[model samples]
Target: MPAGVTTEGCPDSIHQMEVERDDTHSLKRSMSTMQLTMIGVGGTVGTGIFFILSEAVPEAGPGVLVSFLIAAAVAGLTVLCYAELASTIPSSGSSYSYTYATMGELAAFAVGACLILEYGVSAAAVAVGWSEYLNLLLNNLFGIQFPDALSAAPDAGGIINLPAVILVVLCMLLLLRGASESARANAIMVFIKIGVLGVFAAIALTGFNADHFANFAPEGMHGISIAAGSLFFSFIGLDAVATTGDEVKDPKKTIPRALILALGIVTLVYVVVAFAALGAQSAEDFEGQKASLATIVQGVVGSTWPGTLLAVGAVISIFSVTLICMYGQTRILYSMGRDGLVPPVFAKVSPKRSIPLVNTFIVSGAVAILAGLLPLGILADLTSIGTLSAFALVSIGVMVLRRTAPDMHRGFRVPGYPVTPILSVAACIYVISGLHALTLQAFVGWISVALVFYFLWSRKHSELARLQAQAENLTGDQV
Candidate 1:
């Protein structure tokens, strides 16, 4: 046996070699910095800015602006850690792959579970939000809208959310086509969404009222913190850039550049849109406002045309969000499947398309079911908790890799080193702490289920374990 192969499970020389081999042979490196950045921005901006204000504004009142900054701060810190790790140890699994290389297989599986929850549930949540705007757009243009039974989830007093399910299925088809195709589609949507938001800000500022600022912090700092937790769902796209590590061209340089660029674009758009929306309407009025941005615009201009335009933009932009979210989820599962942490079917790529066909289908089906049955609020909260946990792990992984493999070549180093990662971890924890007790409880239960699966199945079937056993047998035969 080669000295690089070892029974010890830490990612040593052999593991790095295997990862490189997989990168070279498995996924195509077709994504450029611009394509990847659009993926990040597309995955992020629509979900929160389009409809999340309805949920977040109620929690923080006029102070939801602070909530946006709070979430952005945490996301900023975590993306730095992601940039460093992605350049240092590129993988399709994102944080889960980072944890495996630095921490070991079991810990990696836990992070994988968190990521599954984050991307999968967030995809469904975004689709549900998409359905709202789709309904509004239809009503505006054609004077027709789906009945509540077809447009809403069961929890929202409907039989099933048909539009949401249809959206997920459409994204699945895009993903099945190929990565580059999806990125191209995403880029077009990103540009349209940005233009729409710019229009919204312009129109909304016309009605800017000073009184909205009168009770800015009505719910205080605690409320701001809670809203930040919910708003963190908006930032999941920043890390979605890292999940394309294996599929991005020159990932070492491309991933970090994309992460920073996407972060800047997303944060700027979010703050501008939130400020404009708040200025146009009182914080109290934001609550329960479906298709909130469009409604705000209509009120400002006293014309349905402006609102209809915004609704058109929301419908198109939110589709890109759902597409990228599902893309990220499938890539993560592909990595896990390759490592024997999940079923092998997830690892299977199409010979012609070079994409995970079965995996995309499975993810789409599951997300479709979730989007059809559950309310958006529940899906968003669950996604936030899961995403925060994964972000925390990535920050910790940076520190662990520094200590364990100090000599590893890093394409980009975090500027502040230990302080940066520590702060990232702290920020994630603080936001997570502000989540509702029910959310925390649900996350705990999810983790428990993951651990049980890890023990009974993943640990035994782990690719690392199989390799270790083979190495030991070879050594014994040599002896």
Candidate 2:
């Protein structure tokens, strides 16, 4: 038996070796810096910007601009840690993989469960938002749209959200084709969305009124803080860049570079859009505006054409968001399956396309159900809770790895080290504290379910445990 091998559970299991070999041969390394950056953009810039104002503006009034800045700053700190870990770790599970390699199996399971919320439910939320924009587009172009019974969830006085479900299924089909194809599609959507936002900014600026700034902080600092927590949903997908580390060219450089670049660009866009929207109308008017950005555009341009263009852009771009988010969910589960934390079927790679087709299908099906049945506000709030929890864990993992494996080779180190990670953790805690009581309750219920599954199932079936038993018996024979 090798010196490090024991029944206590070795760090390097046989299954992991096989998984690594498969990954080397299967997963394609075709993502350049540009592709990677756009993936992050595609993931992060969807519902958060297009539909979030209705919720955020009511919370923070005109001061939501400050919320955007605060959310960006916290996201910035968190992704710096993600860049370092993604560069250091060789797994594709995003924070879950990093936690496993640097922290431990238990922590990895918890993080993985939280990620289900971040990526899976987040996809559902984006799909729901996409449905709204799709309806907006239809109404703008032909003066016709789906009835409430066909377009909304049951809770929202509708039968089913057909468009959201359909969108998820379409993305599922594209993903089954493989990663490269999906990446290309995502790149196209990214450009269309950004271009539309640019046009919106130009038209919105035309109606800018200085008087709207009179009562900027009507709700004070507490409102701004709470609003930042709600707005955190917009920033959830920035770490998708890190999740692609395994498939990216020169990941060491590309991962961190793309993280910073995407974060900066996204933050700037959010700030500009928020400013433009606030200038065009009163903060109180944002509430209950179904398609907020389009409504803002209509107010500014005094016509429906510009709003229609913006809606069309949102409908096009949010498709990419759903695709990428579901992709992230599958890849994370794929890594867990390889590690024996979940069923092996999840880790199974297609021989022809080199993609996890089954996993993708499962994720799409689940997301479609959620998108069709659940309310958007609930999905977004749940996503924020899960994402913030995962970010907090990753931040803590940075400090833990520094103490436990100081010699590990890292492509990029957190610039401020202890301070940055500490601040990241603190920031996550603050935002999480501001979430609604119902959101917290749902998160706790979900975590309880995940932990129960781990204890009764994943822990016993873990490959590392099996390998440890074999190593112990072999060592006895040698003695």
CA shift at 125, candidate 2, in angstroms?
2.3
Error of 1 at 321 (Å): 1.4
Q: What is the C-alpha local distance difference test score of each model?
A: 0.86, 0.83
Q: Which RMSD values do the candidates have, in order?
A: 3.4, 3.7
Model 2 clashing-pair count: 0
Return the top candidate by lDDT: 1
Residue 252's lDDT within candidate 1 is 79
- lDDT, candidate 2, at 247: 71
- Scored against the true structure, residue 304 in model 1 reaches a CA lDDT of 86
Give lDDT tens digits, candidate 1, residues 1-479: 22332324435623643554454348888999999999989888875677889999999998888898988887888999999989877778888888888788888888888989989988898899888878878887888989999988776789999999999989998998899999999999999989989999999999999889899888899899889878876787777898897789888789999999999899889889999999999999988988798889999888888888887787888899889889999999998998888998998888889888899989999999999999988888787778888889899999998887777677899988899999999988887777789999989999999999999988888887887788899999999
lDDT of 2 at 52: 85
